[model samples]
Target: MKQSLTAMALCLTVWLSIPVAFAGPPHGGNPGRGGGGFFDSTNEYRDAVSLQDLQERRRQREERGFERLKQLKWQTGYTMPQHYRSDRYKVDYNYYQLPRPKHGQQWYKVNNDYLLIDDDNTIIQVH
Candidate 1:
């Protein structure tokens, strides 16, 4: 009976001590001063543009691309249907046996008659 009681008391003591040993200061207390999270660096950027500005830029790009394609078609010597109109035009100067110029802005004539038109459609240039 005494041995059984001693074993029970030992068991009780160990059970009680388990929680005490587990209860230490939290591994790392919150930093004493205010600090942002890992992703909260102040130097990081989060600025955003207004939706209207974004939409306007997209629209301008689409318009410019369409006009450029149309111009390429017209300048490439491709025949456009009677009812068809392209925002872009292309003229082919290869048929005339003319040497290709180094600069694209230099105009070239095609079929002894056609003129290549170069124009700024909608691109914005920054100095």
Candidate 2:
């Protein structure tokens, strides 16, 4: 009886070891659903953004920001590192002893035209 049980167990193990092949290759290789069969045809679009493209995008963004800053400086006459009047102030010209926004509240540049203030004094708009 023990030998019969052992044989049955061995048979069960061997049956389990047989790989159950599906009707098609695993999901990643077929376009019918999940597999990468989609690559069978070539198209204009390609995978992965090149580093050059990323750098170009970043350059464009920086240029746009500089242009915006130039326009703002001309319109507001407030240049950085020179301590211009912040919107939180009532007077146009005042000493540095101004009530600045509290901690956690960053100075927000509004509409790229004016500065907007929130309850927390965080700048919400940047034009």
* TM-score of every model versus the real structure: 0.22, 0.25
Residue lDDT tens for model 1, 1-127: 9999999999999998999897644333333333443344341343234566788899999888666645553424344332222433233447544345334322333223344333422111111
Residue-level lDDT of model 2, residues 48-77, one tens digit each, is: 346568889999998887667556533222
Mark the regions of model 1 whose C-alpha exceeds 4 Å error after superposition.
1-49, 74-127
Model 2: per-residue Cα lDDT at residue 25: 55
Q: For model 1, state the Cα shift of residue 107 in Å.
A: 31
The total number of steric clashes, by the backbone 3 Å criterion, in model 1 comes to 16
User: Candidate 1: what lDDT?
Assistant: 0.45
Best by TM-score: 2
Q: Model 2 misses residue 19 by how many Å? A: 21
